[model samples]
Target: MDQLLAQLPPSVVALLDKWDSNVLLITIASFLAWLVWKVIYNRLEILTQKTRFHWDDLILASVSAPISALIWCWPATISLGFILEDYTQSKLDWLSTLKLMLVIGIFVWITMRLVTNIEDYALTQKNRDETTVQAVAKVARLFFIVIGALTIMQSFGLSLSGLLTFGGVGGLIVGLAAKDLLSNFFGGLMIYFDRPFKVGDWVRSPDREIEGTVERIGWRMTIIRTFDKRPLYVPNSVFSSIVVENPSRMLNRRIYETIGVRYDDSQQVSLIVEDIRSMLESHPDIDAKQTLIVNFNGFGPSSLNIMVYTFTKTVNWVRYHKVKQDVLLKIMQIIDNREAQIAFPTQTIKLDLENAGEFAGMQPQTEHQQ
Candidate 1:
């Protein structure tokens, strides 16, 4: 190792020999880069408080520029190869091999940083979806990985065309072996194009009804966070196949209820219907342009039933519930004011034998007295 170290040229030796060794130069370079990066970062962090454009802030927050500078460390290591190569040709090959690996690693790391930057930028948009952003970012990262792999192979003097051809044939065999996985991957693509539901959407399927906000869209799965703070992960293929009702997409939802009136209070049915229609028309949230209906549904065993139905203009569930509640309270007050009774099941019976026996026992004495 000492001979190997000695074989290096004086210029290389001088740089390496400084202070203690070449390690000190590496330390100095690293410290300088770090110092500049930190200074710039502190300035950016201070400026972030004043700026409204958050993506630029994200660029600083993520330290993308710093990450770039850190990647420069690999090239500095590779530069040693150039200096050492002049000393020994065999050492040159070894350095070259090491340089190739470092280059690929740096490329992948930078690619990941770029993906994160894009994802962060997407998150700042008002209408942008977090799921779609992450999905696309992952796709971009995967693309970079494939390219980096090919480049690494090419750097080693591998046949690019032959490798691609072999990969294509091997990919077919691997794909067939994992058909279900591929189905899910393509299903994710379909979801991106079709857009049946988006982030923060509340959806219900036939077997499961859950109110959730979409968290992420992965190649094989979609993640949702429910109102209860639980995460629900469903496969993309399953989501594509199932029938999902997106409540958030609806402009309005119909409210339906039944109110019962007493059999003796049947005369008030038409009046009640008229009052309900008036109530719906006067209500601020109810959609006046749509049909507001109250009709005599049928007679129950003990009461006359009326069906009341209306639609509210707003899609917000909480607001819709409040409006329906207010309408119900007003209708109950109207029923009370009209002096009509709400009916419940009751039984009436007549007694005949007991009264006859008491009168029969007293009839003979009354006849004698007469």
Candidate 2:
């Protein structure tokens, strides 16, 4: 390589000397980085497909670029060292500082990748909730970021004592300015511990009139995907303030109905009520252990009212509806077999000939008829 450069023209040789070491090192580093990245990344991708454990693949994917850069940093620093000795003192100092910063950047990048992958791993655990996992991961990331910043500052020979003192005062101002943000942050923490609802659980807030499946629990907001598929970003603080109903926790679904029989068929009310009660008790879908009430509740103006109160074994909305429908159909069949009728609101008024004279006397007489 040296002989090849020697054979070149004098001007070309001078130009070559200007860029020789740095250029050669960088080219070699880039080639090696590419080769390593391709080989390792492809192998990991194959392994990821073959195995159930995916965290390795995720970590590799996330850190690949940073690892390549870190590899290049070695050659870069060596190249920069050659320039430092030959260049102006100021330029040498700047390059040295830049190289240090580059090293710190790579460290921070790798740390972030590791933290993210760990968080993702936590999410895969059957016992862990998505909201809690996310919160922990975010806190870990923030911690690393703060540490990285402080490390970079310390590398630059900056005093943290003064910064810490200033931060104490500044933090107070920042806390006051971002009170709502702080409140939400703490609210999210409370949710993590309290666990009122989790991701994928259906929840509704009676006060806010919001009902949806929890999509994600973020640091400041909890994302809910409504039944209509609209994304609702609710502040974590709002959850702490309101009553949230998590229907997903229900063991059974309720079915309460009022069926009125016609006054004329009131004689069969006792038999009808007993049959209905027996049907509910023997039904496959109705929960036998739960409350099952069937009785002649009251008499309305036009009918005798029977109240049927029961619970379905299944808590699933669709299945509960199907069970309720089946029960209602069976009830209708029972009523029809007994020669009974379901009643609707109706009214009756009787007029007598003895009362006709008063209405006739109240009518105004026409002039031509008179």
lDDT of 2 by residue, 1-370 (tens): 9889888999878766655466674666567777977797888788888877776777777788797877777676767677676665444555667778888888889878887888877878888878777777888889988988998888788889988999999999999999999999998888888999988999999899799999988889899999999999999999888999999999999999999999999889999999999999999999989999999999899989999999999999998999999999999989998999899899989888897987677565543367
Model 1: runs farther than 4 Å from truth?
1-72, 75-89, 207-213, 224-231, 347-370
The Cα RMSD of model 2 versus the native structure comes to 5.0
Best by TM-score: 2
True-structure RMSD, every candidate: 7.3, 5.0
Per-candidate TM-scores read 0.75, 0.80
TM-score, cand. 2 vs. native:
0.80
Which candidate ranks first by lDDT, i.e. highest?
Answer: 2
Off by over 4 Å in 2: 1-22, 33-55, 84-91, 94-96, 118-128, 350-370
lDDT of 1 by residue, 185-246 (tens): 99898877788887778877786664587777778888889889899998888876778878
TM-score of 1: 0.75
Question: lDDT score, residue 93, model 1?
Answer: 58
